[model samples]
Target: MPYVLLAAAIAAEVGGTTAMKYSEGFSRLWPSIATVIGYVLAFALLAQVLKSMSVGTAYAIWAGVGTASIAVIGMLFMGEAAGVARISGIALVIIGVVLLNLGGSH
Candidate 1:
């Protein structure tokens, strides 16, 4: 399904972003490679999903989910800050995404 692929793309994008943090300005070979590969796969899958989905809806969902997931991953694994405000913002983004999907379906 397109939605499943969109989720996969978001996950891949988050993985890529996390890897980028570990890349140390592109000096680390493995993490850099992972970042490149992950982003490429993410975009590819996103393009595939676009074939069946509205561009605006698909892009908004992709960006929202990817941003929220990446923020959580960064906080958990990259020692990034997880301030209350940031968490609350991410929660709002999730809520918006859910509402968007529900509204679009019916």
Candidate 2:
């Protein structure tokens, strides 16, 4: 299903981003390889998702969800500061994605 593909795409994207932090400017081998592979999978899956969904809707969801997930990963695993402003920003991203989907469905 397209939804499944989209979810996969999101996961790959998140994985890719997370790996990027570990990549250390390409000095590491595995993480850099993972980054390339993850991004490839994400884009490939996203292309498939486009077959059924509008570009605007799909892209908004992809970018919004991917960004939000990365931010959470940073806060939880990467020891990034989790201030109220950053949390609120992530919440706004979710809200914006929801609103975009709602409007796009029509």
Candidate 3:
């Protein structure tokens, strides 16, 4: 299903972003390679998903989910601040994504 592919794409994008944190500005070899591979796979999957899905819907979900996931990852695992503003921003992103999907479905 296209949704499955889109989920995979989102996962790949999240992986790539996580790897980027460990990539040390691309100075590290394995993490850098992982980052590149993850991003490539993500785009490939996303491109496939676009064939059956609306671009606006797919892209909105992709960007929003990736962003929210990264923020949570940073807070929980990466020692980033979990301040109220940041959490609220993430919530707003989710809300916006939901609104976009709802609006696009009709």
Q: What is the C-alpha RMSD of each candidate to the true structure, in Å?
A: 1.4, 1.1, 1.3
**Per-prediction tally of clashes:** 0, 0, 0
List residue ranges in candidate 3 displaced over 4 A.
none
Off by over 4 Å in 2: none
TM-score: which candidate is best? 2
- The CA lDDT of each predicted structure is 0.91, 0.93, 0.94
Per-residue lDDT for 44-66 in model 3, tens only?
99999999989989998999999
Candidate 1 per-residue lDDT over residues 1-106, each given as its tens digit: 9999998998899889889988999999999999999999999999999999888888999999989998888789778899999999999999999988987832
TM for every model, in the order presented, reads 0.93, 0.95, 0.94
Worst 10 residues of 3 by lDDT: 97-106
Task: Indicate the residue-level lDDT of 39 in model 3.
Answer: 99
- Measured on C-alpha atoms, candidate 3 has an lDDT of 0.94
